[model samples]
Target: MANAGQKNRLVAVHLDESIGRGPPDIEHERAVAIFDLIDENSFAPVGKEEGPYKLNLAIAERRLIFDIRKEDDTEVMTHILSLSPFRKIVKDYFVICESYYDAIKSGSPRRIEAIDMGRRGVHDEGSRLLQERLQGKIEVDFDTARRLFTLVCVLHWRG
Candidate 1:
């Protein structure tokens, strides 16, 4: 393992605030890129045979369990940068985040974002904001050293 101060990586996936949005309308190609980045360690997909191989991002050898279980037909991804290695290795990584309410199942704009603090500390406000912003949206917070970013995934369906 690297030293305590080694820099890590953060790969976020979600809506782009730049895109004029109800939620991030992530394209299929971009989606692939987001997933590819998280899989940088090449851990291999789990839960594939029985269901969509899934799990929150793994870090420091353990998995960061999702605040909520991911629903089918839902996806959230965004890119984050300048995060610390410790937090990058543990907090922000993800395999899946269930978005039932606004899930893509029905086809609506949903947003997913990951922030790299590149440091360490616990966050709760953003999580609460997500809960308030989108009914039951999922949020992931990472604490590396001081650098950190919040991953927000919002699911809303539209016809």
Candidate 2:
């Protein structure tokens, strides 16, 4: 059972083939984000529908594709979002993440904490942007938005 506004939650999350394989860290993040999301999330597509949804994430023709389905695997919706708006933030997020990871190895605790704070800021911005973009199509909470944003960034990987 879910709250009134959240009758649909994601029961399954899949990444598309075209997104390509990622490095171990990226793969780990993807796996963990999806796991955390499915374990607890509230995603309800706008309309008179009830679901535990299945989501397939991919990128095609310079657009981010969300192939959404129902619990029984019936198609629900396919929402395509432009990636242009996210390019800068995603790039910044990657740079900050790299810095943070490196800081853990060599930088002082203060330096590591500073870099981590920046990293979290960028992640939060990405999540906010995602929620704004998803305004009419889907509804998700901040934590869900954050996890979904991680998957989006993972999909943005070129190699």
Candidate 3:
């Protein structure tokens, strides 16, 4: 559920291009995260602009771009963030996600659980970092940040 200040929530989200048709699991995760993100979220952009924002995310010129718009397709804001800050976290997240997938396939229950815990921790860190970076650009709750971070990782998948 969105809080009072969450009025600028994203009504739609699109990836500018496919991330190279990765593994099934990665595709699945991307699909689910995008669904969950749009289903309910808090995405208020700063300043006088109010939203039910539409977002198109992409990676270009070695930067992460946030193309935000209004419900009627009017451009509201376009924020470009540097990917340098996220490189390590995205890399770590990818590695842990692979480990988690493998653990699910053959690792012991204890090992799977432990790996899951680490995965969640890394995920939280990524989310926190995303929020910090987006500060003064957009306002998003922790849950929204987590979902958005997943989308960011998806964009990072290609290059």
Instruction: State the lDDT of candidate 3 residue by residue for 25-106, as single tens digits.
Output: 8778889998899888988888948888899998887788999999899999889999898999999999999999999999
**Model 2 stretches with alpha carbons more than 4 Å out:** 1-6
Of 1 and 3, the candidate ranking higher by lDDT: 3
Runs of candidate 1 exceeding 4 Å displacement: 1-24, 28-37, 40-53, 56-139, 142-154
Which pairs clash inside model 2?
Answer: none
Question: Global lDDT of each model?
Answer: 0.27, 0.87, 0.88
> Can you write out model 1's per-residue Cα lDDT over 18-72, one digit (the tens) per residue?
3232334323323543554343311111222222222343222222223211234
Among the numbered candidates, top lDDT falls to 3
Residue 50 in candidate 3 has what lDDT? 83
Model 1 superposed RMSD (Cα): 16.7
Model 2 weakest lDDT span, ten residues long: 1-10
| Tens digits of per-residue lDDT for model 2, 18-105 | 6578887788889999989988787878883888789998888878898899878899888999989999999999889878888888
In candidate 3 the C-alpha lDDT for residue 116 amounts to 93
Model 2 clash tally, residue pairs: 0
